[model samples]
Each structure stands twice: as C-alpha cells, then as structure tokens.
Target: MTNKVIQRLGLLLAAGTGLWGQGSMTVTDAIRKAWVDQAGLKAGQAMVDSRKAEAEGYRDLRLPTLTLQAQGVRTNEPMMAFGIKLNQARIGMADFNPLVLNHPDAIGAYGGSAVLQQPLYTGGRITAARKAGDFMAQAEAASQERRKQETALAVVQAYFGAEVAEQALKWVGDTETWVKGMEDFVGARVNQGLMLESELQRLKAFHAQVDAQKAEVVMQIRSARSGLGLLLGQGPVDGALATPLEPGTPAPAAAPARRPDLVAAELQAKAAGEGAKAAKGNNLPEVGLELGAGTLHHSWSQKGDWTWAGVGVKWKVFSAPDLAKARAAKAQAQAAKDMQIFKEQQAEHETRVAREAVTAAEARYAAAKDALAAAEESRRLREARHKEGLAPLIEVLDAEAAVQGARTLILQSLYELRVSRASLDLATGTPIEGVQP
Candidate 1:
C-alpha cells in the first residue's frame, strides 16, 4: 500500500483530539488523559491523608497527654470512687460533703481535676502501635503507586486498540475500492466478448466478500472506540468528537524497572516486613501516659470537682505460643517478598518476549507487503497480456485474487505487530521516565 492510503486512514481522526495530534502523545499524557479520573484520584489522596492521620495519632503514644477537668453532676448514689492515703495509711472513706453531693446517698463529689500522665514504659505496645500506623501509611503510598500503574496499563491497551481499529477500517475501505475496480474491469471484458459470464459471476462473489470484510472492520472500529472511552473514565462508545488514532513507534525502553506496580510491590513487601517486626515487638514492654480531667457528683445536693492524672507501664507477662504467631507473620512477610520478586521476573520476561514478538511480527508484515507488491505487479502484467489476447481471462482473475489475499495478509500482520508492541509496553510497566509525576 502507498502512504496515501495510510494518510486517508488518519484523516478521519479528529484533528482537535489527542488521538490525532501531529505527534502521538507522550506516555505521560496518555496515562493522565485516559486513566486516573479526577474524582478517583481525589479519593485516593483522601485515603493517604487518613493514613497520615492514623500515623500521627499513633505518634501521640510517645507523648504525655494533658487535659483540664470540669464537671456538673447529680447522683442518687456513688458514681465513682478513689481511695485516699491518710497519715501514710490507705483509708476507704466516702467524702459525703454537700459541696460534692448531687443527691442524698450520693458519695460526696468535690473539685475538678487537671489530669496529666506520661508513659513510663509499655512492653513494646506503644512502639508496635506506632509502627503499625507507619506501616499502614507506607502501604497507602504503595497502593497509590499501584493505581498509577494499573491506569497506565489500561490506557496503553485502549489507546492502541482504537488506533488499530482505525487502521483496519481504512485498509478495508481501500481494499473494497480496489475490488470494485476489478469487478468493473472484468465486466467490461465480458461485454466486449473478451471474458466469460462465469468470470463476471466470480467478480460478484468477490464483491460480496469485500462487503463482509467491510462489516467486520466497522464492528472492530466501534469496539475500539468504546474501549478508548472506557479508559478515559467515560461511557463506552462515547469517545469525544476530537478523538482520533495516530501511528507512531513505541519506545521500548520507555518501560523501565520502575514501573509503578513493580515499585508498589516492592514497597508493599517492605511494609509487610515492617508489620512482621511490629508483630514480634508486641512481646516487649509498652509504655502509656494517661491524662484526664473530669468531676464526680458525690452528693444529692452538692456539686463535685474534677481531677485526674496518671501514668502506666505494661509488660506482657505471658501468652499462649506468641512465638508461633510472630513466626507466622514473618513467614507471611517472606511470602510477600517472594511474590514481589516473582512479579518483577514475570514483567521482565514478558517484556523480552514482547520485544521478540514485535520483531517477528514486523518481519512478517514486511514480507507480506513485499508479497502484495509482487502480486499487484503480476496482476498488472496478466491484465496487459489478456488485453493483447496472449493470456486467458482466468489467469488475470487468479492474479487479482493473489493481490487481494496478499493485501489482507499484509494488513493483518501489521495489526498483529502493533498489538504485540502494545502488550510489550504493558508488560514492562512502562519506563519510569515515561510515568506521570
């Protein structure tokens, strides 16, 4: 085929659309334009913020809590109690002073308390809590990266799908035109008594075949348009008026080791290890600081005061086979690590295979093109010979069929190469430099 035919295929693309730009969009633009809707991205960001909040809350475990106390209470009976040390002796006594009483029979309640307590030590409980929060935050980050990778892959497939379908449609259109021309030429020969009626009938059958091919191409084009729309976070079959397909070379190295999904997997594996560490650390000491301000109404007729402050430490005295549980967590982490490695290996292998496939497909397409060119030249010679009365009509007809068949094979081969290149791009997790920021 000539460049003119390829140019016609592109002319149908909306010039205003990303699909028909003078140059194909960079991978970064395609990813953003096709995937990662604003709403979904915002939601992802909110999740990250939530993770940060959780981390911050856990960080508070290492700091003392301070609070002021104030309370208004009325109680028919004692609502709360605290023992007092009188003269170095612990005395169990209810202060029934009216100033603290909310009602009769209510333990006397008094002044408000300003409570403050700092963690003395926790058997690694606080540390584990904090670490867990940190791990969660890290996981959230990884999840975001994974989202990016997923979107990129989706865009790659969809964008190229549209491009391929457009190409197919154009090729089919051109072939149909050529088939009609052949039919006309054969019919003219028959009218001139130079071709048989059966030959004319054969041309009609060929025309019918072309019609069927056209239908298939139309369907394929519609499907591709839908796929592209879906990637852009829009309804299928709703591609913008400006949407168009453009042809270009895919940069093989654009996919790098830093594919977002791969990076995310690595981070997730690390987070899993952190979780395992935190789980094991649960066996150690945990320190806590508690501070509260609240008042108790001790009397039926009197108001109560608020006062509070405390600090505490906890040591996990004993547990049932915690070692086994911790070991399980470690094992889980190891499994995650293995999975991450496997994913990387899989991506690399697929990329290499895709590269080879693309090369092979290209070779096939080139061979097919050459075959079609040869077939066309042969058909031309036969037609000339038949006009000169030196060749039978059958020979010309056969030559035409060869040309058409070769054209179809050439188109199919080119399509396969494009599809394989797309697959390779998806496999490699696209180059880090090609990724959107």
Candidate 2:
C-alpha cells in the first residue's frame, strides 16, 4: 500500500488504545493527558514537593537536639591519672602522697554521656527561617500551577494546528477530484475536435499543481501530529483528533484575576522579606539550656555516675560579615518586591492585548464565513455555465480555485479564533479543561 494508506492505518490502530480508545481524542482529553505525562510539568511538581519537604525540615528547628558520646582512654601522665581516678571515684589516701602524685601509675577510664540541648531563645532567627521556608514552598506550588496552564496552552495550539492541516488537506483532495474529472472531459473533447489539445494540456498542468499542494499539506499534517505527540510526552502519534476546526465563540470577559505566576512572585517577595529578617536575627544573642548525664568507670568494680544541667548564652558582638549579609538580604528583599509590582503591571497589559486579539479573531472568522458562501455560489454558477457551453473551461477552473482558497481562509480564521480564545483564557488565569491553576 502507499504511504498515505499506511499512515491512515497507523492512525486507526493508535485510536484503539488508551485515551484514543474512545474514538478520536478531543482537545480536553489531550490537555489532561499532557498534564499527566509531560516531563516539564512533572519536573515542576517535583520542585514543589522538594520545597515542601525543605519547609518541613525548617519547621523542625524548634525541637531539642540529643547527642550521645562514648570514650575510653588510658594515660600514665600524673595529672590525667589523678583526674581519671577522681572521676571514677577511686581516689585513695595514698594518692595524696607527693611521691605517688608526682609519679602515678597508668590509669584507664571508660566514659559515656547523653546530652540534650533545647533552644531557649534564638533571637527570632528560627521563626523567620521557618516562615521563609513556608513562603518558598507556597511560591513553588504557585509556580507549578502556572506551568500547568502554560502546558495546557501549548496542547491547545498543537492540537488545533493538526486539525487545520487536516482540514486543508481535505479541501485539496476535493479540488484534485474536480480537476481529474475536467482532465478526462477535456481529453474526450480534444479527441472529438470539440476542444483544443492545448486545453487538455492546461487542465493536466493544473492537476499536477493540485497534487503538489496535497503532498505539501500531508507533510504539514504529519509534522503537526509529531509536535502534538512531543507535547503529550509521547513519541510521534498518528491518531485522529476528534476536535473540529470550527470558529470558537467568545465568552463574556471577566476582570483579569491574579495569575499563578503573579501569585508566585508575591509569595517569593514575602519569602525574601522573611529571609532578610532571618539574616538580621543572626546579629542578636542566642540562649539555650543543656542537660547531660555521664558515667565514668576505672574498673568494673569501681564506677562513678553524675548528672548536670546548665543554661548558656551566645552573642556575636561585632561581626562585619553578618552585618553585610543582613544589609544585602534586605536589599534583595526590596528588589523582589519591586519586581513583583512590575510583573503585575505587565500582566495587566497582557490581558488587555489578549482580549483585543480574541475580538479581532472573531471578526475575521465571521468575514471568512461570508466570503466562503459567496465563493461557493460563484463556483456553482461557473460550473453550470461551463456545462451549458456558455462559459470557458478556464473560468470553471478559476471559480473552483477561488472556492478552495475561500475555504482555506475560513479554516485559517477559525483556527485563529480558537487559539485567540484559548489565549484570552490563559491571560485571564482561567482554568483550562477544568484544571485550576
């Protein structure tokens, strides 16, 4: 079989599995499929998860820290030997002798300790850090939502682009059939001396042109399908799309809502502010409480155990680096806030532009429909006249070409209208395929 037939068979087979199993896949189905399988969106979700995990870690900073240590040592040094004997509670009256104290025998001691340290105060550093982490996680989650919307927008474009190519190809096929019939009619007329040989040759040349156009359109259709597959996180797909290339109706425009990216920026700004506070907190004093219990044994028969509790304060009196870091963090926070404001303004502009584009697309689609109607009527009249021998074959051919051109234009305008409507939804932060951003 020819490549075209093989391609068609491949499409039919693909339609028998997965989402396509229900029949030709619709635009909504394609968007949902891409949401599940697209690698970029998966990566975005992973980043959000990672941020949440980090935030959890930051929140756990308030808990106490426990450390356990074990040590065994033998020393012949007089001072160490005396200390070891004292710690093991094995000191003897003989150890008081100057001769023994100056020249002590080797002593061995084993010790173990468990220490717990709880923060009493951290100058708000821990709180700020936790808040910053939470904000970062929220920001990442919002960013992921924006990524989903962006992915949905891409699926819409690729899906409809394939439909446009297929529609054009269908019209080209009709034109080809018409030209073939004309070629046969002209050839028979030439044989009967009713039509010139040059007329038949002219008809044959137009037929070649139509065939060439069909081949180009077929390539376009193949390319669009491959691109759609890539967006869906699959390799080349050859399934028929159920979504038709019809003009999209414009929805009532609502005031633009805050897009996910804008929300992300706002959250990121808050996170930066918290980060600055955390950095500033580094300059303040810290306080903590520690509780420890330990045991020391010189021999199995002679052992000493003790417990202790204490509180400590730590202050960095003058650290130039800490001061600089705090200043830098504050500056960065301000910059982030400023950037968020700029993005909000830019988003407003984008929404306005997108709405205008939708309106223009709708108008163009309506005009194309009217033009197609006129072209179809003209084609019918020209063909009728040619059949009655009142019009030239060339006028019939031209009329057919005009009708095909008009049909192509209508398809193009309808595709644009669909895309523009989708773009408007994207700009307004509207949900796509019922997926909330």
Candidate 3:
C-alpha cells in the first residue's frame, strides 16, 4: 500500500503543471517567477520606455537642429524672372531670351537649403522640460519597481496558500483513513463480543466526521490549485499542483534596504518633485537661434550665382497673467510633497505590522506544537488504559479525537507562521531572492 501511494504521488507530480523537483515549490521561487512573467510587469516596462524617450527629447534642448528643404520648377516662364545683364542683376520681373538664358541653363526655382536652429532659451520651458523629464523617468522607474515588488508578494501569498491547502488535504486523508481503521477495529472487536456495539457505532460516527472533513479539504485544494496556477502563469485547466506537501524550509531574511517597493516609493517622490519644478519653470522665457542658406540659379545649367544666408533669435520675456500658472504649479508640487510624506508613513506602518505578525505566528506555532505532543501522549495513555479495562471506550475515543484535532491545529499554525514570515519580508522592504520555478 505504501509503494502504491508513492507511485500515485509520482503520477500526480508528473501530471501537475506547477510542481518543482520532488517537493512543493518554494514560495520565493514562485514569487520571483511571477514578477518577471506577469503581463502587468511588461506593461509597466513599456511606460519606462516612454519615459526614456521623453528624457531623450529633453536632451535635444541643448543641441542644434538642421532642416533640409528642396524645390523644383519647370515653368513656361520664370515665376520671378530676372533679366541678367552682362554685369548686373534685376530684382523685378524681366523676360530674357530663352535661348540666351538657356545657354546659361537658368534654373529659376531649383534650390535646397539646410536650415539650422538652436534653442538658446525658453522662458523657463526648456529648463522646466528638462527637469520634468528627469522626474518622469524617476517616476516610471519607481512604478516599475513597485510593480515587480507587488507581483513578487502576490505570488508568494498564492503559492504558500496553495501549499497550505495541499497539506490540509493530506492531513485530512490520513486522519480519515485512520478513523476508518478505528471503526473497523471496533466492529471486529464487537463481533467477537470483546467490545460493545455502542463503541463500534461511536467509532463509525468519528469516521463519518473525518470523511466530511476530508471532502472539505479536497474542495479547498481545488480552489487553491486555481490560485496557484494563476500565480505561476498557468491556466486553471492545467493539472492541479501535486507536489509533496512537505514542511517548508527556512529562508534567510534579505537586507531591508534592498526592498523594491520602498525604493520605488522613494523614486516616485523624487519624480513628483521634479514634475513640480518643471511646472514652475514653465513661466521662464525661452530663447532660440535660427540659421538658413539658399541658392538660386538663373538657368537650368546653374550658371547664375545667387546665394543667401541669415540668422535670427527669439525670446518669451514676459506674460502679464503668468502668476496664476506659477501658483498652480506650486500647489501641485506641494501636493506631491504631501503624498511623499504619507507614503513614508505607510511604509513604516507596514513594517511594524509585518514584525508583529511574525512574532505572533512564531508564538502560536510553538504553542500548537506543544499541544499536539501532549494530546498525542494523552491519546496513547487512554488507548492503553482502555485495553486494560481501566478506561471507558468513550474516554479513549475522546482522547483520540483530541489528538487528531491537535494535529490539524498544528498544521494550520505552521502554515500561518510561514505565510506570516513571507508577509514580513515584503512589509519590511526585504524581498526573498529566488530563481524562477
């Protein structure tokens, strides 16, 4: 029977979608994998690209720009014909002999110019834009970090939750079998007139209760399987997770400072501040420089020597009603600063809560372990006493029930402790590092 059970376990593991190695997959591994695989993380990454482009656009502020322009014309007559004398040129319209102009191959409208422009200043728009880019990048980066961190935490919770359910199922299965065995044993004894029929009936009642509990655990496992699938990026229709429901091994705590969520929040605040600065800078004047070159030929042959060059500048020195705009920007900055303050407070609160949960779970686990041991001892004593005719069958049954109950409680408490530990790592800004499952 033991070998058959092992074979069944193997078959289940082979069919399961989320199993890792020979044991239940680690929570940390599951979380890190989900973080990298979740669609939302990829979407957040796209935002980062946009922010980078915005920053690159800002870098263009200090660089020169060049534009190329070209035009072609084969007119019946020059739109602005210039009658070129041997040594002179005229601005007004004049018809020259087509043959003579043709000899020089006049190209009245066939010229291209390369124009260059430089932003010398923008009433503070350029500076503001640069600052805004910086902040925007920071914000997006922070947002990405936040997304990754949240994904990790979510995966951890879901993975361990499924694990707990699996463990529960195993516990129920074992207890149910044991209860059935007890019933059969009592029936055999009663058939031989060694135990009362009432004792057999009581054992049967206990078996029924165990069966009910087992059914509930099975349903719980199904729900847990769905959650685990989602976290591992597997579809719910995949074979349910079938890894061994072993107790989780301890994982080392990470450095609190390395917490991604905390870093992300910090970056967000910085980004917000930058945005506010950019808004304020919008009121400043912007300056720019422009340059262009053009050449016109009198004939298609390009004998006409005509050239032009120019440079210009601009500035937005003042706006009479700009106070409202500046004030609005100031208000926005203040709001962001306030948000930063709130975020910091929230981080501290989460950290404290995580610490308390870990402490509580640890204490509860210790207590449950002791209770389970004591109950098992009591049951053993009661069973011996009943066989010796010193205890009633009801007392022995009661003691056995207590032992089973303690086992269930211990399982629950252990799961709770591990879950709490995972939460603490997340809350304290110390994520468990792990490879993909």
At residue 173, give the lDDT of candidate 3. 77
lDDT of 1 by residue, 1-437 (tens): 23333343333322112231224454456567644554565577789899989989988988876666654443355333322112112223444555434433432344456667787665455676676678677778767766655665556555555565565566667767866776788788889998789978866776676676567556556656555555565555433223233335655463255565676677667767766776776677666667665544334444333444555667676665776777988998899899999988987897799889979988898798899889989989998897677887678767866765675566556656655765665666553225544
Computed on alpha carbons, the lDDT of every model, listed in order, comes to 0.61, 0.80, 0.61
lDDT by residue (tens digit), candidate 3, 100-215: 45454443355556778887655556666676677678767766776676676565555555555566567667766766766776777789898888888777776676665656
TM-score-superior candidate, 2 or 3? 2
On TM-score, the candidate that comes out on top is 2
Cα error of candidate 2 at position 359, Å: 0.6
Per-residue lDDT of 1-437 in model 2, one digit per residue for the tens? 12343243234222212212134788888888888998989998999999999999999999999999999999889999998888888888999999999998888899899999999898899999999999999999999988989888888777777777766767777778888888887788789888779888878877777776677667666666677777888877877778765844445555656799999999999999999999998999999999999999977878998999999999998899999999999999999999999999988898899989988988988898999999889989988887677899788877776776667667667767887777877878887534543
Model 1 misses residue 228 by how many Å? 0.9
Q: What TM-score against the true fold does each predicted structure earn?
A: 0.72, 0.88, 0.75
Off by over 4 Å in 2: 1-22, 75-82, 93-107, 247-257, 385-394, 433-437
